[model samples]
Target: MDLPDPQFSEFVTAFLKDRGLPVEDLQFHSLPSDGSKRLFWRLSPQSDTSFVAMENTPTDDFSKRENVAYLMIGRHLFQKDLPVPEIHHFDLANGWFILDDFGDASLQESALPKERRISLYESAIEILFRIQTEGVEGFNTEWCCQTERYDQYVMQRYEANYFRDAFLHKYLGLKKDWPELENPFNHLAATASRADNQFFLHRDFQSRNIMVSAGKIGILDWQGGRLGPLAYDLASLLIDPYTGLSSSERDEIYQHYLRFLNKYDPRQVEPFRKYFPYLAVQRNLQILGAFSFLSKMRGKTFFEDYISPALKSLRHLLEDLKDPQLSPLKEAVHS
Candidate 1:
């Protein structure tokens, strides 16, 4: 992809100069884009300091709001002692900011031994607990990029319909009458919507968004967080396709999360477990939809590589869940 404009480079240099950082030998390198519209760069100088510059095009009001939220939420999380990068400077008018360079030690990029994987996940789960409890105290709903709550409308319209339109119809070209799957889709959404929404949720809590450095886990890309079901993030973490965590490993992590929950609120463990599978189905389907949309429509083929793993996760979760109401949806996915 093309690098950011030369003006952006000059802007970064000026931003650094204002911060009293040496700018004589500053170098800028573009970072690979994820599925978002944001552009990232790594800025390094003669000193032993580096920062990541994120630039967002304020194309519309939604984009502007999202950029603002990134700064607002990053500061909030940092103040709450969460493991988010510290924001050094931000320009809301131009939609760019400087952040601490956490380096590229994301959990998704790490090759973990079995025992090490378990320990790291334990740490990650502990962070999740704190983010849910402590991070919710002063969080503002207006800072949320999307809906304030992951309610039934979001589950049904944004996730389920996204799967139908993007994955089933657009990517696979499946023209069959899929009316039979509607009941199961609605049932799954309804079930997930009833989950506890009293905690902060990291909507995309997968391995790729988790940075691991010096045996510490730092969370990233949390501008989309909102008040939602506690089980949603847990399901996202455990059933993540990128990590390729085995079923046994997932079971162990699930149990570990329950134990963690029990230490604080014992009453929530049973219901959380009961609702996890349903959320897994919903989450996995949403991943497939995103992969399809990104690959086919947006011309980002890298996302397509994860589709098979996502499908494997979806089928496995469906098989493990013997709910009769989900049979049609299961068959639809299996086909």
Candidate 2:
């Protein structure tokens, strides 16, 4: 068995001991890691409810920022009565924290039937809408670890350029063809920039990050939260390739969200609709880049399986929109 670091285990042990919780026969079990550098472990004890611990040892500049964001944004959300885990103890310099454990089942692993699944998605949407609206209050842009706002620069560099460099050139062997995408990529970024970006955004609000704990939705991987277009996160959820929600099923769920959006502001709905597809395409592009990089370069092969389906989704979306500015992007995915 891969044992936890003695110091970290001691950290958890002492932290629990101070809270009057027994730590007898304590054991640490390592959990599977995702694309990010953060590490997770399940801390089990003799009888108390188990808690999870996080290790955010930074390997680079971005990861260093990720650690801070996880703490600041995480505490901020917990204070807002959001569904995030309760942070118990943290050692920022040492990069470890203990939290309430929601268990191993993700929304991706949710085994409900179609109708019940949609119902669960409805709950997810409700929580997300609250996160979007209420999360803006007391949210400091300074607390953001990534780009403070989802702007054109973020679209170009992280989404479009990432797609070309990582997914196309690196993964698909289209090295020479990237130059052709410059113009349309610029256009797409500019178009997506028109969406309102003041709303709180969870940059990766997909099924895998959602936890369905005993029938309630609990969100994780929230360190990437930032001020972004309202459409982007919703688009990420609806088009998540892992869940493989059908076109009609997505439509049904989308309508459910529209009702909520309408309740928030009737005028915002039309504008949200106008810019949603562009934002969705931007999200899909980022997805391709991220998945390819994680799968091929980082050796996390789990994401490799979703690339084809994501591309197919992008192609279908473009074909339906028939937008001229994105034609080059469609062509790139086609090749």
Candidate 3:
């Protein structure tokens, strides 16, 4: 994509100069357009030190409570020594943020040897466990809606329907009769709204939201958080569209997560396991619809890469479900 206007670039250059950094040409590296809410640029001023300049778009305005809750959670993760980016400075009023420049260190472009992949994922799993256990404090779970509370009447339900109707039918030619889907849809909604599974959800916790630097992974794009099932974020990561980890690798991670959860709260372990597959199925379907909507209506097909893994997860979820109410939907998807 073309770089943003020279005015913004010049403004950033001047801002850095006033900060007494250095004097030279300013080079800006804008990331891909998949994440539109935030704009990232690498500000290099010919000096040894460099930093990342970020601007949160207007659409990313979060409630003060949500913002504070996220920051508190981020701080808690940092305190636990998790490999997340450090916030340098933030101007919420102007939507400008500066963070430590991790430098060409992303899993997408990593030059690490093959042997290091397992270690990286292991570390990621460990930290995820820590968050699910200890990261429950910063946010109020009682207020934040859980996946179980996400019924057909919930406002979020429209996100899925809109994705399907406006995008899948309108653009992809994959149309579903609302009447045929009503029963299964209602069942899915009721199942989710039972509020059975609840935990700290990272909302967008996935590989793309993760940064790999110095053989460590750091999480970003966590402005939206809530109290929900751990599986939501776990599925988002392992079944991430940008990166589809192998089945064996995903299984290994799932086992690791189970172990961690069991150790954290033995009582909730069974419930988590019982509901994890259901959450995965629900989340995968929502994502599939969202991807189509984003690709068609929103004019961003970047989510296409995530479709196959998401489908695979749907299949796996189906294998775990013995509930008759969900079987028809599973058949519809599989068919």
Question: Of models 1 and 3, which has the larger lDDT?
Answer: 1
lDDT of 1 by residue, 1-335 (tens): 55767777888888788878898867678887678878888988755888999999788989888987888888999999899999988888889888988888878776366668888888899999899888889989889888898888888887888899899999999974578878998899999887899889888998888889899999999888889888899989988878889878888888888888898899998888889889888888889899999999999999999999998888989999999999998888888
Return the clash pairs for model 2, or none: none
Count clashes in each candidate, considering only residues at least 3 apart in sequence or on different chains. Answer: 0, 0, 3
User: Per-residue lDDT of 92-190 in model 3, one digit per residue for the tens?
Assistant: 555556666766655544523556666777777777766755666554543432232334454236544653474346645766555566676676666
Q: How close is candidate 1 to the true structure, as a TM-score?
A: 0.96
lDDT of each: 0.86, 0.88, 0.62
Q: What order do candidates take by lDDT, descending?
A: 2, 1, 3
TM-score per prediction, in order, is 0.96, 0.97, 0.81
Cα RMSD for predicted model 2? 1.3
Best candidate (score: TM-score): 2
Off by over 4 Å in 1: none
For candidate 3, list the clashing residue pairs, or say none: 148-192, 148-193, 241-306
Q: Give the TM-score of candidate 2.
A: 0.97
Model 2, range 1-335, lDDT digits (tens) per residue?
A: 55667888888889989887778777788887788766888887655578999888776777778888898999999999999999989987778889989889888889346656888898999999999999998899887888999999999999998888899889888774567788988888888899899999999999999999889999998899899989999999988998999999789888999999999999999999999988999999999999999999999999999999999988988888789877877877777
